[model samples]
Target: KAVALQKLTYLSSLHFAPVASHPLAFPAIELIASPQLPHRRLAYLAASLSLHPASLSLLPLATHQLHKDLSPSTSSAANHHVTALALQLLASPAAAAAPDLPVHLAHDLVPHLSRGSPRAIAAAARVIAASPSAAVPVLFKPLAACLASPDPRASAAAAAAFCELSAPPADAAPFLPLAPDLYNLLTTSRSNWALIKVLKVFARLAPLESRLAARIVDPVCQLLARSAAMSLTFECIRTVLTALPAHDAAVRLAIGKAKEFLAAEDDPNLRYLGLLALGMLGPAYASTLHECRGVIAQSLGDADSNICREALHLMMGLIDDSNVTDIAGMLVSHASKSDPEFANDILGAVLSACGRNVYELVSDFDWYVSLLTDMGRNLHCAQGDEIGRQLVDVGLRVQDARPELVHSSRTLLIDPALLGNHLLCPVLSAAAWVSGEYVNFTKDPVELVEALLQPRISLLPMSVRAVYIQAVLKVITFCCNLYVERLSDSSKEVSVALNGLSMDQTVSGGSDAPIGSSNGQITVPRMMEKDPFSLKSVVHMIN
Candidate 1:
């Protein structure tokens, strides 16, 4: 019978699901009624492996036998192994999914948990959690009591269960009373795994109670200091970063440990995790994150994509009104050098950071406008739509930015090479719009008109072509108006101003300077110029 049960178990493992036609399915279910304990346990295993959730109801006989073995009056129940087999069967995911399992077996399950049966604790916790109305009143006390159990097995199992229970999406507030017991475990337990679980629970709980952070800080720090285990150290680092920031001493220790994680040159995962831990620090810890800039920047070019991504996230987090220009320059340069996928990710991150909250971090519109044009010009650049929107958006929202935006727009408009790239079309369209909207800002409008009408613009979508045509009309209108305004004086000067304009407008654009000094002196910078478009007018570009 044992040999036959083993064969059945082997067959069950072959198929993820069994049909009614399978040879082993019904026989495995019948074997659950076997008198021999080994036969019963193996039969349960076969049935569990073979059966699908929908067919769980076929287990009425198996369920009845399980109840019999679990009953205290039964001679088998007195045998710990027999009781463990019954608990294992009852706790199996297939059985636990059954709506009636908890209803029929929960009363029997609670005692094993109360007595600190290690296996029973994990399985029963799972079963209790699955119940629609968790038998919280009947089950929680025993479960929490297991934390205080003298046996390490019971304590570890209980801590793991509570860690899961108190995790996010499951409110930890209800488990607050368990904190005292968890604290005891934290202070005394030598088991690294158990301590990690307890730390998880405390991490969530600390945010809920102001005083809890004070209680757990010292022990977590001691663990951080004494433990050689990377996992435990990371958990402590996370607890500090997430919930115990007020402890300056602990936070500094965590940051020091995180830098050690970054220092692991051969292990990409540790480096990635190090960046993740550091990223969790709030604005107050910006200096610590900034101090790791050299290591983080090096990570951007690492062979591992995960480390690169984390590095990019931390880099974006470091930006503000003060360093946005320099950081934006570094990212744009890096994007140009990366493969297509990571390049686009870098571009997207920078665009999001600078553009977040209506360019709140942007202090110099000139520099930002230049950065936008530089990003649009990358060969692998696929972020055209957003770049286009930001260009037009900045022009509309920032009055002082119109001149720089116009210069940037003219830079894009005149690029015959860029007009061929479908990816650059959105940027071109935005440029045309900006050039048209703020034609007065251009160094020269006549040259702007000729560039807008460049032949390669035929490669543009009809929508973008429409934009080019509109920009051409705007430039013409501006020239006619400016010319007429000048005609009242000297048509020759107007013609000379129009003639110097560079019809082959330069694609180079970007600047961090304001358009004009406080004394109203103009300071034109790269990527765009301040001139009206005509050969001589455009030819004499602003410096």
Candidate 2:
């Protein structure tokens, strides 16, 4: 027997290793057949460690030995240990491979749930918890009785098992009657572990039944208020918020506790949890959350990215017409301060919020335009692409609502400093498109025309360059059409202004004047000296 024990230990160690053969099963069975309790316990332990789903042939022999050891004739100590080992084995991959094993064990284990020994009851409850859902009805009554057991360990185990069995919609009906009793346990139980288990069961049941959820809100809030354990507090908060309606007094109590957690707790993880709870509650309790806006915004700068992200999302949800500017500014500040890796995601969230809320939040279109221009100048690559699109979209919407705002946006986009910021390619591209599409809206057509041909236009990507080319052609064509109309009326001012336009001198005189000449003039071909759409000039400029 001692030799068998040594061999078992050695084989168990190698169970997970790549081995061609397993030789420990027969010896383990031989040890179990021994009349000695010690040998039987070791044999069961060895079998659990060495047996796996792949060892299908030896499963029945091991199951038979476990069944015999669980008989009433077995000693109490041996019976408890054997039952524990049986529960452990049932959870093993080998037992899972045997389709009928759990059903058989559930039948054998149901009687042990009412046993006087706490260990026996705990072990039995664990086995029941692991049993298939089909066995829940059979074991429900006995496990429910164990919920009131004197032993905290057994009660916790029973609560866990009951939660698992009661998870299905059809099976949940049986637990309705136990709601008050579960609440009683949550409030009166001294053991945090037991309360946590009960709270989990409550969380699952509350969403399905409104009355039960409503009833437990006070008790869950009480748990959150008094508990110092962060894990228990978090679980209680989740249970209360998830199960109870947002307007319930109990939910307010829970949110209050979460606020306390956010302020008092220095741990980033706990603060993160607090922020998450508040985030879920924010939309329903916007007024209540207003006080914590500073606290939530502070988390955006948290050293931990997860906390920052959670805070950002929560802040985004809190945005309304009243707070859009403040929230948007905070997001932009954080984006600028954050690592480049996270900046894009933060900016993307900002743009999304602005797009969805712009009509309601933005009363001052100028301020909105300036915000986009700043974001565009600061952003680059993919981040710039999204911001630019949002800028164009917001600009067009503003233009639609108030046509007068088009000149303001055009002025901002035409600033030499802004046009030179290559990072603002999308913004520039959007501006170019807008200028072309809304050419008649420009207050000073000549200035708009000249600003389109910045010296560094060639530095733009091919796509944006194409947009610039289209914009310039549209503006010049519009100008030429206006010039022709003026000539037909013989307006001398129109002729003089057209001649003063430096583009005419460069083309008419055929001078190779440098672009952006000494007098800050744009050197382009004269309007009548060369065809605006000539292939030769287009190729020359493109080159």
Candidate 3:
């Protein structure tokens, strides 16, 4: 049977002669409808016919007949198969020829799908979503019921349908009233994936549905304020953050309040996401800088890497050079007593801020050195190998800018195990050679060199290995270039000192002392390193 089907397929392809432009070149409908046929042949026939839009209108009729042929009392497997076929038909672009499906066909299927089976409704929703623009209104009531349905599948389908419908500016009105219901479900339900789908729908619809944003902000804000469960609150936070950019001032104000709530919450993920939102809100609410400053500082102490990463993102957007000194001071003070985890948070935030102001802050060698020294110290002492490596990467970048800071952070470079952490190693290597110079002169000379020659070098793949090699050689060459450029200058001694470090390989490896390794501990910096140039100079000479 399969052989015969394959031959038939070949014959059909051949029948459609070159440049004829005729669509019905084969007997597809008769072969597919043949009952003695194998299901595989039927599936192939369907796929072949799906290339033409005209063949799509025949699908619902065929599918409905298939359903009728099977007794409902039979097991649901057959019903599922037929439904899947219907969904596949609807998802195909070829179905566009019959986009305006008859209302009765859809209405009759709604009751069957609504009776607690999520799969069926999801399939039905796809069909409704694929219908023509004029057919959307006809599908709305059933679509809305799917959203409120207890079945998670139906909820997801409804959300997808809503997202599709809201793509056009004119179709957003019908979705406004559904926002509150979605917000409520997101907060009260255990189904996070469903909420994510719904939030996507809201994001698509919210631009033109300001009234929906206005109506739901209060409740969404309250949910974010109180929910400790990150998964449950994820969409609520994202929706509130996305809505903050709306043209309405009321929506922006609501987001400000939500930002305050996020700052108070201890969840790192929420804090991170919230901080990112606040960054976007910066220009809109510059007057609230003092209030926002505190939130950003608190987020810098979050435990999660991504959360801290987000906090750093927010800080960059919130504070510029005129405000940099104060913001940097706040970060230093907040992270002073913070444990390793908290220090990691601060490091991520600082790195994020650096990306925004690399040109401005990179030149402040002293300050950059001190920050790297602090982060590297924590990285060496802390148990968070992951965070430690990240800090080390950033520390390397600081070293690249101000070799003087290397004395303090240099000890962190040689830990082979630290280099083994794939996530942070590449980042660290990139930072080291970003200036296209070797880290030849610093407080600890061998730190950068050993980082380059570590035994684990062979374990890395060609791509990453190439990256490390290129970055290291570039930094070395860059240092050499800098030396050549400034050799004739009177301040050459200071430049030489800044680029030179002790060659002693005294430290066998990174310090084992646990600084911020504790899962629950949070600490702040007690003091700032005062001799940035000396530390950086030692690292440059060593590398």
Candidate 4:
């Protein structure tokens, strides 16, 4: 028996080596059937390493050996190793493929949860956790009892199983009674691994149970502060952020700790977690977010794109009416220096944020126009085009409120240097629309017209040239209508003044004579009207 066990150990070791041969399945089987506990343990270990799904012929014998090891009369040491191997086999794809195998294994493992050694109990809990829902109800109460075990491994495994089984709301109700114990473990447990497991279970439960969510916050926040493990701290922060309400004091504590992580930690990943937490809590803590602004803005220039993107998103969320200009300026600066892909992301985020909050942001329209103009002047064509599109959107949205700003936009759009820029299409389109609609408000219509019809207009693309022509036509027509209205009003005033003068003369009994005429015969000044044909000819010539 000792020789066979020795051989099985050698075979198992060989199976793991790079150039190892196939396991001696026949020899392994002989050892598994042995009555000695040491021999059986080694045999099961060897089989687990060597047995493949193709070795279907050994299924019956393996099943028999597992049952023997799990039997109530089995020694504790033997049960520990055997149950672990059994659970491993049950989790294997080959065992899962066998009809009724998981069910039978789950049935045999349920009893061990109460009576087995710690290792065996943990192994049993893991297997049961993976079992179907039909096996959960029968196993839940027994597993819940293991949470009180002095053995931390057993308790942790039991907690993990509870999480798996109680995934559904209806199934989770039975585990509610254990919440206090779980919270205690989360707060007081020495093992980081155990605390993480418990925290996950609570995170999952928190969403369904609001009271439970509130209860877990303080513990989770405490963990975030004290835990040095990056993974653990990240998980704790995420739990608090995702599970708790923003107004909860625990969430505030978690955000405070997370900001520390972002500032103090150099790891990009931890910083990412920190950024995520701050983002979730930023709105609720807006008054205090100024402390994090420099950190987040600096992160926008990080070497890692992931950190940069997260920081960018958080920065965008923090922007408001009072801070749009500063935030927008920062973004434009970053976009100017970033790679094309990241620059695109930055530009896109700015446009989206500003567009959504345009009503609140329009008051800063002049600064925004200048920013867009600078961007167009500095960026490459593709990026510049993106800026131009945003500029056009901003222009159209703000025109009704600040029509005077259109002149500023017009000056930028019609620059000789900017006129030929292919990226200026959207800008020019917006400018044309603004000029045509608000030309009357322009202080110097002739200068505005000159800017619109610079020599560069002839060099513009056909589409833009068409737009320019239409805008000029609208301005000209408006000016003509104003001229005609003013001319008619002036003529009516003159006619009324002349009639009043003549009436005064008749009352004084003096000879009536035209005001400008020296002869006795009364003469009226001829009201010469502008020739409609001549005006039409001039318009036709301009066209």
Model 2: how far residue 473 lies from native, Å: 2.3
What's every prediction's RMSD, in angstroms?
Answer: 9.6, 6.9, 15.6, 12.4
**Cα shift from native, residue 48, model 4 (Å):** 14
Query: Which lDDT tens digits does candidate 1 get at residues 1-543?
Result: 557657656655565444334555676777777777777777768765654565666757567766766666655443556667777765667655565665567777677887798777776676667773756766788888999999998999999988877777888889999999999999999999999999999999999999999988888999999899999999999999999988899999999999999999888888988999999888788888889998889899999998899999899888888888888899999999999999999999999999888889988988999999999989889999999999988888889988888888877877788977899889998999988878777776667777877677778899998988887777677765664475458766444334323232222214522343234332223322333532223223222
For model 2, what is the error of residue 321's alpha carbon versus the real structure, in angstroms, after optimal superposition? 2.2
Task: Please give the TM-score that candidate 3 achieves against the real structure.
Answer: 0.42
- Please name the candidate that would achieve the greatest TM-score relative to the true structure: 1
Model 1: runs farther than 4 Å from truth?
1-31, 34-62, 72-86, 89-96, 132-134, 209-211, 444-450, 480-485, 488-543
The lDDT of each candidate is 0.79, 0.66, 0.52, 0.65
Q: Write the per-residue lDDT of candidate 4 for residues 274-361, one digit (tens) a residue.
A: 8877876635567656778888898988898999999988888778888888898889888888987888788777766766744466
Deviation from native of the Cα of residue 253 in model 3, angstroms: 12
Rank list by lDDT:
1, 2, 4, 3
**Candidate 1, run of 10 with poorest lDDT:** 500-509
Candidate 1: residue 253 Cα off by (Å): 2.0
lDDT of 3 by residue, 1-543 (tens): 444445555555577521112333233333434444355345434444444454554455454443442224445665555545544544444444454432334554555554634544554555565554544565566667777777666676666656666665536666777776676666565565666666666765666666766665665566556666655465665666566455454445446555655765655555665665565453656655456666665656666667666666666566676776667656755566666565556656665565453445544656655554454444323323433343445545555543543443344455565565554544444344432243444532334555666778776666667766775565555444554444447464434333332232221212221123223211211221222222233234333
Instruction: Give model 1's TM-score versus the native structure.
Output: 0.79
The regions of model 2 sitting more than 4 angstroms off are 1-73, 76-83, 92-100, 116-133, 164-172, 204-225, 244-253, 280-284, 357-366, 394-428, 440-461, 491-543
Model 2: per-residue Cα lDDT over 1-543, one tens digit each: 546566657755666641114465667666767767677667766665655455656666666766765565656775667666666665554444454556666666665666634444544444555554655667667767877777777777767766655665535665777776687778778888888888878877777787777677777777777778888988887877776755377787778778877886468887888898886673567776687888998888888999888988888888887878888887777777778767777778877777764456677666666666556655432467776676667656656532443465476556766655666777778877877777767656555655677676777788987887798788767766655664567565444435545333332234433344355443433443354333223323333
Measured on C-alpha atoms, candidate 3 has an lDDT of: 0.52
